[model samples]
Target: MKVIIAVLSAVLLHCTQAMAAAQTGFFIDAPITGIQYVTSSGIEGQTDQGAYQFSDGDVVDFYLGEGPSAFHLASVSAEKWVSPNSMTVTHTRTINMTRLLLAMSDFNKSDNILTVNQAKISQPAVQDFLGELNLIELDTLAQRYDIEIPSVGEAAAHLQSSYQYIKQSLSSDEIVYAPRDTELRDILIKTRNYQGHLCFYNVDEIDNPSYVGPVGSTTYKITNKGIFEYPDNGDRYGSNDGVIASCDVDLRAKRTEEEFHEVSSFEGWSGLFACALKGCTRTNLSGYVVEEYDSGNSYKYRANAMTFNPSTQIVLNKKQGLGQHEKVDGPNNAEFIWFTFASRDVTPLSFEGQWQEKQINKEGVSYRCLDIKQGQVWATPFSDSHCRARNSAGFKNASVEFGDMWWLQSSAKDLYFYHLNIPVAWKDSNQTQHYTTWEYLPVSDSLNNGILYRYQQILDEKDQSLRTSQVSELTKL
Candidate 1:
């Protein structure tokens, strides 16, 4: 009797678990509406309130229309909230699904409640257009329909396509076929409006907020208009003619809370070179060095010194002499912190002009001028009071011109600046030939108390180790 009771209890637990897994869930990435979904367990229906019912361990496939003319969108795992990010299908399918939703949203421009028309999508021409459609062609269709689609690329007025009419129809669906649920509609609208930049790093975290990590990290720029550009060399310095893609990207506020915390200034250093006239002293630095920038005219930062000694070995060689130290102070240090606050009215084109360095005196504090001209960033010394007048006259012979710099404005009107291809020389274990490599500086903006905080990555040349460290603070002037 005892054995039979134990077996029955185990069976009941299994059934309960199975039933919980098969519960109803919603599809989101902003709660897509009026789409058909089929589960692996053969459960099929149109998503009501973005809802779907499925058995445990079921794979859900989404579609547009029914039968022969149906367009198979994405196949993803049956979960509480299925989204493009949750898709189990290939990346191509995920991208296409996202594009389709974006196109639908663009068509229904009055609100964020994305409702698709089955009659329009089921048409033969529309199916053909969707089959051959690439992301770059969305804008052309938007214009033909006299509708605006928020994208990251420039509008090509003369872009010709054979399926132009089909695209236009898809962009401007005439009949509202689906039932409107005001309560459900509001939920979708709220989710869509709250969407921020789809970054590689979680923007919610204060530490490692942006893509400030290892060398192999994905480095791409998405403009306010929705144009996505991925540089071949990983840094967007020289030219953006490499590869262009489009997505639902926006430059929104990364962090919502208003708080400030200081991180280690020397978070990525393996060792420090304490050099003198006669000889150089090498001291292995461990852990992190936090610096407070409450008030200071000059700020000091670290860079990767070009050397063959591995970071692991350098840490082991604590307080040891490493011959005569070369006067190798690279262009990694900036004399003054420059702040650029972009108003909501500023467009990408208007923000791309040459910026001259101006001496700003705020709260009785004088700062050096840092200006940009034709992608080159010129940093002037604070000692030179006449830097502003000279900068107006084309100060080509400035103190330092960090090559090929760029800036992007976020949706919250915060501006981010970057310096690319800064050279760092290093050697291998075999001590073969001295090779110079480039490093990228992605400026962080953690704003608090009228001051914009910036963090920079310090690289260890020997082993290519990288860590994000707080470098500078910019106060609004």
Candidate 2:
């Protein structure tokens, strides 16, 4: 009986020795699997503009097994749980992979103790992905634009693949630590290729305790398929400003540098011409011609571009002007006619295809031309009978000046008139009579010579004779 008891004691001692050895293999305080814990208030579906928020001071649970035992929101301290944002835990508590196991082995629940067979845990995939993500800088602009970045709660979501990868590449010498910034979470997420480059917007780093929000914003692409372009505001609209600015990405690249291929670019005045006359019957017609816009008051400004020309079938002279055999000027101020028409010898101006016309008024016409797009003006002429009327039937080129606005006349002269001032108002030009884009040009003062009946040589969509107005305003005189 004594021999049997001795044998049992030896066996028990051997088991005890084995257990101690196993315990020694694991670091007493090795980091547990879970370091992230969402606050109690972070139940689900709480967001501002589809963004989730995280608060500090939440008690996180680190478990021994990756399968059933991992870190989670086991509980929270009463003092720390009062307010979600109030959970400010001291940074003094540092938990890592090496020390987590040693710190919790004495717990009654074995599952609560973090453990691994080896002293070091390796995960290359997680590390590789995290490493790649670390190179990416997270800015407020990136967040607003929806670029992927890391967050505190994202590691567990990708634990299986990420953990195994990091484990394979991990070594005792080098350890992967928890990212201080949550943006690393975004880098781990696999996403589609982005086509647009980044353009930094604003920066406001002073608003938060971490001084993070002030990093500003940058515009970048979400997809890499080389799809449509993204405007400055990140949205496409139908306004003149939107359409005019939405030039082809490739075309912009060719004109600018190769780097701008990924940035937004526009042709400016050329783009406006395209928007105004694209799909017209005379799309083939090209050459610099005169285009005018009204100033906020009573003046007008005209610009000359090579793309401006009459796209109509009407017989016109080589030069576009009042009477036959007269020289017409380019849209620029250098070519603008400043005649007040106070004398009978008012010169007849020649137009494309041998057409000719001239102003007949003798009361001294006066007007000024402004270039709103360029924010400048032509020779500010203040004279009498300054308005000029086109004898042609083309309505698109005709313009009528009202109290304080200029309306764009369409081919049909019956569509919604576009407001020149605000650019977005496609409503009726005259409040008394609701007009369409192609409706009759409304006149304000008949004696005041508010409307200048002129016609552009632009053609219609069906290859029909189309004439549109460039601009109209009150007689500057």
Candidate 3:
């Protein structure tokens, strides 16, 4: 029994040692090659195709050239994919290292890999030139290469531009940079080939019969560049649909927390009574929000509530030639708007042909409609003349101008008529004029043989009021 136990202990020790052995990784920001890397674990070599091998907990320092003349560029913990930005601790240092890397790289190569020009970078003259450059000089160099580095408080914008520049320069569809010990790196390694259809549902509509809401379906694809949604048309108001950012994976919850920005406009009026009202207020609002989503299960994502100040202009009496206006600042105000989405495997369905309004609320309805070949909806049923005639009793000469219609397919294989900033004006019976815009997403229902239109919420221009629900249906005509 002692002999057997000794043999088993030996085997276990061997296995543990093997697990601690060096693992392969890459240096990117275009897969830089021919750079020497030395790890604290004693592993040292010039990167081949940007590849290196190091064990966990190892700190790596990168250099150029050889012998006493070799120049140290940056030092970072061993990672699967290391870039200049990841190696540096401060933004200024990151920019400096990035500029040096760009200056030393051979961009004319056809393979899209950045091969460090050893001959040029090793020269004392070239080193001096790069070392003497200050922030303004670096900015000039970046501009010459058409690369944009955003100002302070614009990290998101800078990252976006970096991603775009890398994508364009490489002409490659997949581009990713994973720093050490990051969830993004783990996610990329685990789901490198993941691609499918994702259906989005509003958080409040998950318990509803059809999971219907403002959000719809989109194709989610994973590339080295991170997850992107195909045909991402910014479905939700003031929110972008493509290229989710700052994603942190939660394996236990099977979801990822992502950051996004929501932009909107604020408007207000100041007056005690109708006779005293003669002022206008408008302000633009933008802020970041974080939301969570599970790739394989139903999850909810919400935009953070935000606050903003409104700019106001007042005119006391227009008829008295008191057209003089004074600008005033209003107190800070806040707003919160959020929705959730559910996803499923994409089922193929073509929405290329024409679909006509068939029924609304179980009542037969007909409308002349044509789906333009260029993916536009041209329907004449809701013209200005029709609107004026229908609401003539309450609003005289009322006009409704329909905005461009963009068709969006949902995960349920139905369609949503997405419209934006549709201007509407009407004069009430008392001749008081009103003007505003409307944004709405009206969804469709699938019958055994026909499509049915259901009730949809319409948001007014200010996003403060709800317009009356408009129900309509359409079928292939």
Candidate 4:
């Protein structure tokens, strides 16, 4: 059951009357009829992180416009203290409509009661509450026999019923947020005035639950549907020649616990090196390392999955070391708190979990290296270079060679590269172990791929760019 405990805050009075032209055709110019504030503590204990509660106030502003009388809750704002507190809010249009229905002389005071002749405003829910307040309940025979009671004065009857339905529904664990439409009607009935005068809409009591948080807690922002447009027409070539496509994507990472160590240090060890030392900025990475081997112990590899802070690119190393991260792919300098690195160069002949320094023959030159996988050096006596020596004509077919590989060092120096074997898979499955997940999905093409690459020339260099790279879908799991 989801029970919502609404805590009302102490009333802070600051009512002002300001006149402005109506933005819609149905706007009104009613003076300040009445003002009131209400706060609520959300359900659950106070210490529950991210729990939401709120404070709201009513605005009795009325203006003249087209259409029948109606009211709406426009905005809600809350205080910012560490403990929850109250904030101000507005609901003008709905108040005006309810006032019109009541047909009262004054808008703010709850002194007078006007009769509603038409059944248009009296709904089934409203009638149910009125049945409880009828004078028929005082009759002995009616009470003894448990007879049904008819609705009283229409205005009060409907108002009471509307209020009761909202209260009952709100108190139930079965309900989450209040139904915006049903509650809007209650506001309309309470704020109506027949003489075309706007009035204060108030109820002496409301069945808000116990205040759970401080006082005012959560805030809500209101907006109409006409404010934005999502252009999703299966535009495959979303971006090109100044045009952009809509897209979004998510990436995850994994590592082999046995094969990798959270590189403690990589200062002086060597055989081959591939370090990125661009603008050494810190990045948050969340991925895993992997270990692979073969008969000759040679492996080929690469970093496949990715996501990082666009401000700082992600960096990885075969051996653990401390340094700033640089962008390897994605944005120019995207930073990531989530990343994974794997060694794609090297073959393991035999290894033992003992730290050792060793050398491998690459083009007759011995290079120094260390392995966290076995934590032992490669013994030259037991080593055999299985150089299949296939057609090395730039990736034509399958082949192997025990020669030196090359890569760029952080100092922009050319360093011997190695061959490592790393495996990768692409899947966006959300299986949470602790925290809730919210996926920000960007628009995808017909194929449902989150990324789209297009060739374009902003100046004279034609290059590929990711178009419409923004969040387009969201869901909590």
Best prediction by lDDT = 3
Candidate number of the best TM-score? 3
Please state every model's RMSD to the true fold in angstroms: 28.5, 34.4, 29.5, 34.1
Once superposed on the true structure, which residue ranges of model 3 sit more than 4 Å away at CA?
Answer: 1-20, 127-477
TM-score per candidate, chains pooled: 0.28, 0.14, 0.29, 0.13
lDDT of each: 0.33, 0.22, 0.37, 0.19
Candidate 4 TM-score, C-alpha based:
0.13
Per-residue lDDT tens digits of candidate 4, residues 342-416?
Answer: 222111222112112212111121211222121212221212222222222322111111101011112212211
Estimate candidate 2's RMSD in Å: 34.4
Error of 3 at 283 (Å): 35
Query: Going through the candidates in order, what is the number of backbone clashes in each?
Result: 6, 103, 8, 77
Q: How are the candidates ranked when ordered by lDDT, highest leading?
A: 3, 1, 2, 4
Please write out the lDDT profile of model 3 over residues 156-246, one tens digit for every residue. 2333243344334323222121111112111010100011111122222223453222232222333333343333312222113422311
How far is 226's C-alpha from truth in model 3 (Å)? 28
Clashing pairs in 3: 199-342, 199-343, 200-341, 201-340, 201-341, 201-342, 202-340, 203-340
Alpha-carbon deviation at 103 in model 1, angstroms? 3.0
